[model samples]
Structures are given as C-alpha cells and as structure tokens.
Target: MTSQKLSIINISYKNDESVRVLTAVLSKWFSNPKTLHFTSPNLKYPFNINHWISTFYNEDNIETYILKDENWIIGHISVKIDENKNLAHLFHLFIDNENRQKGYAKKLIRYVEKHIIAGKDNIKAINLNCVKKNIPAITLYQSIGFQILKEKKWLKMIKYIDKK
Candidate 1:
C-alpha cells in the first residue's frame, strides 16, 4: 500500500479536456514497449494523439476512470464493455510509477467489476490480455483469482471471471 491517497472517478466521452490530460499522462507512462503497447495495431508511444482523440470521441462502449491524488492526476483505467459476450474487458490499465504499489490497482479493479456487475445483466467475465513477460501483472491477476486458461506467444491469455 502507498502512502499517497487517491480517488477514482468515471469519465464521460464528452469530456475532451479530461481525455487529453489522460492521454498525456498515459503517453508518458507507456512511452516504452517494455511497459505497455497496443496489442492489436502493435504501436508504441508516443502513441498517435489523433488516434487516441478519435477513440475517446467515438467509442461508445469505452469508459475511462481517473485516479486523482488531491489536485494531481496519477492514473486511469480504460474499460470496454462487450455486451454481446457479456464481458467487460480492461483495455488500458496504467498507474503512474510513483503512485504504484499502493492499493489503487486493486481498487480500480474492484470499481470496474462492480460497474460491470451493475451495468450488465449477465456479464460472465472481465477479460484482459496481458503480455506474458509482465510478471507483476500476471501475479496480480492470479492473486485476484484470475486463472490463465490459454496462452499465446507474448500475446493472448484468457481468464474467465470467477463470479462469486
């Protein structure tokens, strides 16, 4: 747990200013492929600001949460809900290095899980694809009862949500 206090708030797509702020923070945090990268298009930071802007403006299922510490923004989590599959997938989960090792990540996960449970009637799983190389993430997910069902070369590993 970190000494710094933080709060998570849901953001609407209409808020461009907040999105831009998040983009700036994420761009800095995800500047290296070693830390994070686009798994689909396979791109690295500085990720195209225009592309992110378009995503923020157009994606209907997208929901962003801002983690704020007093007046400063520390991190955010982006979730995309797939109603067809009844799944809420975590697309972007980034915490500023300085604010990490706190309970923020777990809190964010719990927040999103609650949102999923409340918003969708039959959501079965909350899925996320993490690089196999990210040991910390793997450990964290496992700690949260996420089991690795399948694995691809540094790519895909599916975890079925354990609805308890």
Candidate 2:
C-alpha cells in the first residue's frame, strides 16, 4: 500500500469549524469508557466542545495541532512547552479510529520532534504519558526512542533530544 502525505497544522481560534469537527471525532472515540479513561481521566463522558475549549485552548503555552492528509484532518495532538524547565509535554494525542495503523501517528510525532523539540535548542526533552494497558502507543513511543521513565498506573515516557 502507498503511504499518505500528512501535514500538521497548529490549531487556532480562527479554525473553529476544524476544532468542532475534531471535538466530534474525539467524542465518538472517547465514548468507550476505557478509551476515555486512558486519554483523559479528568474529562467527563460525552465530550463537549465547550469543555474541550476551556480545557485545552485557554492556556497560552499549550498549542493544539491537527494532522491532515490532503484536506482531511485525521489526527490531533497538543503540546505544552515549559521554557523554565526546557521541556515539552505532549497530551491528548489521538488518531481517528478509521485511520489507525497508517503511520499518521508517527508522522505527527516526528513533526513535533523536528519542529518543536529539536527545533528549539534549549528544549531538553519531550514527555508523554499513556495508560499501561495501551500497548500500541507504548510500542510506537519506544520505536521513536522514548524510554519509560518509571512503572506506574500511568506510564510516563520521555524522549531526550538535546545532546548538550
């Protein structure tokens, strides 16, 4: 099978429609209690756009990204950079259910690594957390050089990019 080309677009308030669609996609997937608990433990069921906006959009340092293949947005991720700590934290990474196992997640991750983590000289590492039961995500992160920080209910992983 041929690979699809993907682009990561930084989400903004102007892209209201895109965010709404993304929210819909998220709501659909998170309807499963297990999926919802894994991705967003604090979030309530039946994900709403208003709550999503209030949770993710209000922070200045956190930037949401949409992964698009051609004109279709098939994935989403959010990054929050801590300049003081020289760290970037990845949160709420999701690929549309219909589009999984297609390398979209890897492309999105590499985009973040190149443009966000490695692009900034001071950034020391990128960190993310996943449910321990989520083996696919753990495997993907490991393949991309992330190592488990410690064993816990939520597995924390880090990929260090700064050589200095």
Candidate 3:
C-alpha cells in the first residue's frame, strides 16, 4: 500500500445483483476450510443466499464496507455500533487471496475507524474476536492498537478511541 487513497463503499443498503455477486464471492472465500476456520463467522461455509441477504440489509445498526484497490475488490469489513453500550463491534474483515500482505488490511481497518465509526455518538471502544491460532490477523490487530481483552474460547480484542 502506498500513500494513494483507497476506495471504499457501503454495500449493506442494497439487495440486488451486486449484493448477489457479493454473496457468491463471500461464500467461495469462506468455503475454503482454512479461511472458514480463521474468520469463524456465524454463517456456515456456502451459506444460504437468502439468509445472508436478509442479514445484510435488515441489520439496522451495522454497515458493511467493501475496500477496493482502485477498480479491484480487495476486501470487505463490517462494523456494528451499539449506542446504549457506547461501543462498536468489528467483524467479517477479509482480504482476497492476492491482496494479502500488502497493508490493505490495515488501511481498511483504519478507514473504517476514522471514517465510519469514530464520529458515531459516544462510541468509546471498538472490539473484535478472532481465533488465537490466526497469528497474522492477531498481530495485525495488535499493531493497529487493538489489545487483547480476553483469552477464553475465542480471543477478543479492543481499542479505545477518542472522539475529540
């Protein structure tokens, strides 16, 4: 990644062909056993399209963003804000096979923090969960200021942000 700006778009508001394409690609990516084990999203590998579609559009507080390297789709991530709890939960962060190790993951995460979730009302901490065995992901998260919050069944991490 360079100093060049990356392109990101919110795709959670639609239920169209584009979303259909998104679901297919997401399914293919998750279908890989390694990817499935690392990310550990709620949906099963090769998830039902209708269910994923409904989950995507009907979630009121969550917004999913697609990160692009110019015209190519590099990755996608979602953020869910809990107003009453003053926190935001990050999930479903992934980079495509060819885009890994290029600093795009950090770029995507920071873009969401600064552009999407930071100014939201009273959102004090951003949190996420990942498998302990996923060392690369864990290291990346730690490098970007996410500290381990727990080490139980699933590794949980958090970073507190200043709105001011």
Candidate 4:
C-alpha cells in the first residue's frame, strides 16, 4: 500500500480541463458505496456532480484539491479560507477505497496545511468537522496534530499553525 509518487493538484475555477478530469474521477467514485457513505450519507448514491462542481465555483474562498497517484485521481480535499477569521477550514476529504490506510490522507492534509501556512501569514489555524461515528477519521486527525475543539453531531477539530 506504499505509494512513492503522489501529487496533490489544486482544481482551478477557470480550468475546464481540470474540472473535466475531476468530474470523470468523481463520477465513478460517487457510485461506490464506500465513497458515498463517507462523503454524503444523506444524499443518494448517484450524487449530482454538476451541482457539486457549481458549488465549488460559487465560493470565492474555497479551493478544491485532487490527490493523484501516478495519474489516477484517488482522493479529494477542499479548504475554505476566511481572512477575517484567520482560519482555513478543510473539508470534503475522501480517499478511494483502494488507497485507504496507506498514509495518503495524512500526507494530503499536511501538504495543504503547509501550503496554507506558506501562502498566508494571517491564517493561524486549520479546521475541519467530522461525523461522530467516524473513529478512523478522528484518530487520523488526532495523529496529525488536530485537536478536538467541540463535539456534537459533527466533531469540530482545529490545528493551530505557527508560520516561520
């Protein structure tokens, strides 16, 4: 389950080719029960990819990233940055079934955190929320220096970063 060449590519709002590539990967991933259950349990299996893409475009502060292993898109994550709050919220983190438990999720999260810390001096913390029952996800977050800040239907977690 070890991957040597992993890439995290940001999906640009102005790039049609990137959108098409992501849509194609998501179209197949969205059909799998594992992906659907982990992503949007309330929504039906055949989720609306177009609607999802539209929302990604509608948000000015949100940046979507795709994880690729040797050209195959295996995971996705997004971050919503708030300058006023000085916080970057990470969400929509999903790794394909085949790529799970191989340390890719942590790598992606760390990459994004470093990217944000490097890109902005005002971003003081990174945040994310996960379902209460997702123990593996919670453990992964904890292992990566994220702390549980609050708990409810969705557990709120935060990791404060020091930019040097």
Residues 1-164 of candidate 2: C-alpha lDDT, one tens digit per residue: 13476678988644777666776667777878777777776678766667877876677888778887777778888888988999999988888788999887888888887787776788888999898889999999999999999887789899988565
Residue-pair clashes per candidate: 0, 0, 0, 0
Kindly list the per-residue Cα lDDT of model 3 for residues 1-164, writing each as its tens digit.
Answer: 44345688877546486676687677777778678667655656656667665654577888888887666677988888888999999987899887789887898899889888877868899999998888999999999999998998779999999766
- Tell me the lDDT of model 3 at 76: 85
List runs of model 4 lying over 4 Å from the truth: 1-3, 41-44
Q: Rate the local accuracy (lDDT) of all candidates.
A: 0.69, 0.81, 0.81, 0.81
Displacement of the residue 55 alpha carbon in candidate 3, Å:
5.5
| TM-score of every model versus the real structure | 0.82, 0.87, 0.87, 0.86
Position 112, candidate 1: lDDT: 82
Error of 2 at 35 (Å): 2.1
On residues 1-164, what C-alpha lDDT tens digit does candidate 4 reach at each position? 35657888888755888877777777787877656666655456676767776745577888888888877888888889998999998988988878889887898898888776559889999998888788999999999889999987678999998776
Off by over 4 Å in 2: 1-5, 13-15
Error of 2 at 49 (Å): 2.6
Inter-residue clash pairs, candidate 2? none
